[model samples]
Target: MLRIADKTFNSRLLLGSGKFASPQLMQQAVAASNCQLVTLALKRLELDKPQDDLLSPLKAMNVQLLPNTSGAKTAKEAVFAAELAREALQTHWLKLEIHPDARYLMPDPIETLLAAEQLVKRGFVVLPYCSADPVLCKRLEQVGCAAVMPLGAAIGSNQGLQTRAMLEIIIEQATVPVIIDAGLGAPSHAAAAMELGAAAVLVNTAIASSDNPVAMAHAFALAVEAGHSAFTAGLAHHNNQAIASSPFTDFLAAL
Candidate 1:
C-alpha cells in the first residue's frame, strides 16, 4: 500500500481522464488501467444542469477524483478554481497545474508554490505539477504537499523521460511521493522510471492518445506492476565486464 498523506492507494499507476475519444472509452481505459486515482479537469462542469452521468461511471468503478486546475492563469485564479473544483467534484484532493505558457503547458513554479501553500492551509490535498528541479520539489514538499509531480519532459511530447537526470535528483531528495508525470509515451518508459524508484507515475496522453486506449491501459498496468516488482526484488548491479566467480583476479592464488 502506497500512502499519500492520509490516503493509501493500491495501484501505483495514476490515470488521467483527458484527451479520450469518448467518456465510455475513458471508463473502459480506467477499468483496464486498474487505476484507483483519476485526474479530472474542472472546466467541463455545468453548474445548473450538472451532468453527473460522466462522473457516475467512474464513481461506479470506485475511483477517487483528483480535480485539476488545468487552465488557471494566476495563483489567485488557481486558488479560486480549486474552491470551485471542490464544490463541483466534491473533493479537496486537487492536482494543481498553473501553466502561464500555453505552447508546452509547462507549469509555472512560482504560481504553483503559492497555490500549494494556500491549498494545504485550506484543508486540501494538494499535488503540484512542476519541472523536474530538486530545489522546486523541496520547496513544495516543505509546504505540506501530498506529492510532487515532476515532468519527465514536455507535456504530450512523447519524448519518454528527457528530464531523467533531474527527475532522479528530485526523487532522491523528495520527502513526499515523486510521481514522474508527462512525457511518458510508452509503458516501457513508465517501467524504466519505476525501476529508478519513482513512487508512482501519472499517465494520460500515452493512454488516451493511443490507437486503442483500453488495450494500451492494460499494457501500461502490466508494465508498471512488472517494474515495481523488479524494484522490490533488487535488480542486479551493472558492471562493465563479467567478473570471474573464482579467485582468478588474485595473483597469489593464480597457478
Candidate 2:
C-alpha cells in the first residue's frame, strides 16, 4: 500500500495506454493489469474537440490518469501541455518529459529538471522521465517530484533494462519512489526489475504491442506481484561456498 500524493496503490506496477490496437482492447488490458495508474501521451490527444475519443475510453477504465508531455521539446512547452492535460482530464498528475533532440528520443536533463520544478510548484504531481544519470535524478528529487522515472532503454526499442546498473543506483539512492520507465519488452524484465527493488515500472510498448494484450496484461500483473514479493521477502544472496544440503555439523559428528 504505497501512497503517492493522495492516491493509494496496492500494485506498484504502472501501465501506459499506448500502441494498443483498439480502445476496447486497451480497456480489457487495463482491467487485467490491475494497475491503478496509467500514462497517456499528451501528443496523441486532440483536446480541441468538445468530446475526446481517447480520453473518454480511458476515463471509463477508472484508473488514475497520468498525462505525459511526450512531444514537448522545451520546459515552457511541457508546462503548457501539462496544464492542458489537467484541464481536459481534470487531474494534476503529470509525467514530465522534454526532449529537444528527437533522434534518440532521449530526455533533456536540464529541461526535465526545470520543468519538474515548475510543475511541482504548480500543484501537479510531477514524475519526470530522465536518463539513467544518478545526479540528474537527485536534482529532480530536490525539486520535490513525486517520483523519478528513468528509462531502461530507448523508448519503444524493446531492448529492455539497458540501464540496469544505473537503475540500481537510482533505486538505492532515491528518497521518493524510483519507477523504471521504457524499453521493457516482457513480463520477465518487469519481474527482474521488481526483484532489484525498484518501487515500480512504467510499461507501455511491451504490453500494448503484445499479440494477446489481455493475457499479456495478466502476465505482467502476476510477474510484478512475484517480483515485489521476492523483494519484500529479501532474496538470499549467492555464496561462493558449495555447502551441502545435509546438516554439516551433524554429519561431521556422525563421521
Task: Judging by TM-score against the true structure, name the best candidate.
Answer: 1
Q: How far is each candidate from the true structure, as Cα RMSD in Å?
A: 3.7, 2.9
Q: Positional deviation of 20 in candidate 1, in angstroms?
A: 0.8
TM-score of 2: 0.91
C-alpha lDDT of all candidate models, in order:
0.91, 0.88
True-structure lDDT of candidate 2: 0.88
lDDT of predicted model 1: 0.91
Q: Which candidate number would show the highest lDDT if scored against the true structure?
A: 1
Model 1, 1-255: lDDT tens digits are 678989898899999998999899999999999999999987754678846478889899999999999999889999999999999888999999899898988999998999999999999999999988899999999999999999998888888889989888998888899998999999999998898889999999999999999999999999898888888888989899998778775677656
Window of ten residues with lowest summed lDDT in model 2: 43-52
In model 1, what are the clashing residue pairs, if there are any? none
Residues 99-176 of candidate 2 have per-residue lDDT tens digits of 888778999998899899999999999999899999999999999999899999988888888999999898889898
